[model samples]
Target: MRDKLTTIGFDADDTLWHNERFFQLTQAYFAELLADHADHDHLMERLLAAEKRNIQHYGYGIKGFTLSMIETAIEVTEDRVPARVIRQLVEAGQEMLAHPIELLPHAREAIEAVAETHKVLLITKGDLIDQERKLAQSGLGELFDGVEIVSEKTAATYAEIFDQYGDGPDASMMIGNSMRSDVVAPIEAGCWGVHVPHGLVWEVEQAEVPTSNPRFRELKDLGDLSALIDQIS
Candidate 1:
């Protein structure tokens, strides 16, 4: 086993701070707006499907989210829907941009504890400006040694970053909430991966929960993370 851990990569959005909750709240409002046209469950299905299909075309962030909402409204709304309904959707998107940012449970203390022994790096994916604003407001930005805000996370992404930083699989780890994006991608890239479940996961990012991977260990929250790392290290 590797005795020394040199670099640790972390996913920022849902991992270090609250994120999907805002999206959920926005979606709930959307369901109410279109209640006359379709039921809540069907609206969610259309919205989730649209999001997945538009990942490349719309990219990620509030812009994509807003556009997805608009598309869903168009698809599900009754014939000749009022202009005010469209305006309402647009306004909701703007509201999302102004949504207050909150840190996740135990984020600060866990990052602080891990930073003492590892060269901590923040690897997150989203709209550049929005993410920067969130990190700046988060107050935990100063706790990390490096912050990488990317448009997406993949095996190639991890490999390039690890190679450029002069760290390999054994001495580095990727910590985040999304199983497919965070856990699977980094581990496939040859780095240790730790899975931390979040309160809300967007339907676009949801996948089958894997129960069989020695390299992947599940933890309750950031508070328990430091001790887990200490044991493995």
Candidate 2:
């Protein structure tokens, strides 16, 4: 273990719990509904492209993604599109809105393990109400020493968080799923980062390749996290 360690920041959403799986299912449903008008793969491509183009307008979350699907379906099929598909989209949207919250496997165990020797902080971004609700449902709300719900995770955000919690970069580490927002941001801010990759990562959260660095490491899953943290320290 390191002689002087202070804090570790963790990402929420896919990192701490199951996320994006619902969006994948919703996309599958959307494809089925649009099968008569266009190929499933083509429809998905168009929808994804539209979402990317309108990211600044719609932001992230199920509501925006569903809206993009609906808008794209209308565009591809024209106004003659069947009511059944539209209705299905509406119902699917509602189901996604109501989807239950759940924790990722080994999330709490990882948090508890790290918290034993470091100040564990949660660094997540989303609609404040929605994020807070998820955290409440996670059943490990009390585990974090600090909680930051930002609009975006950037180098500046990581720097601010580290500055507020610890003296310098060496005293802190970031453990999360997204290399772009979680790992890269903190690393650029001068803190070390450990990536715990989830099976499903959102496209928007992807990062460019890293050449190599001793302060950055990737783990297969949360199960390998504690051991890596020990090794790093």
| Candidate of highest lDDT | 1
> Can you list the residue pairs that collide in candidate 2?
17-104
Give per-residue lDDT, candidate 1, residue 213.
62
lDDT for each residue of candidate 2 in 139-216, tens digit (9 for 90 to 100): 889999889988778788888987887665667888888888888888887788888888788777898745486678
TM-score of each: 0.93, 0.89
For candidate 1, write residues 1-233 as lDDT tens digits.
55366788889889988888888888899889889999899889999888888889878888898888888888886445678988998898888787777888888888888889888888999888888888888898898888888878888988888666647665778999998888888888877788899968876666666567666778888788888888878
Global lDDT of model 1:
0.83
What C-alpha lDDT do the candidate models reach, one value each? 0.83, 0.81
Residue 3's C-alpha lDDT in candidate 2? 35
Candidate 1: residue 225 Cα off by (Å): 1.6
After TM-score superposition, the amount by which residue 46's alpha carbon in candidate 1 deviates from its true location, in angstroms, is 1.3
Of the candidates shown, which would achieve the greatest TM-score relative to the real structure? 1
Collision count of model 1: 0
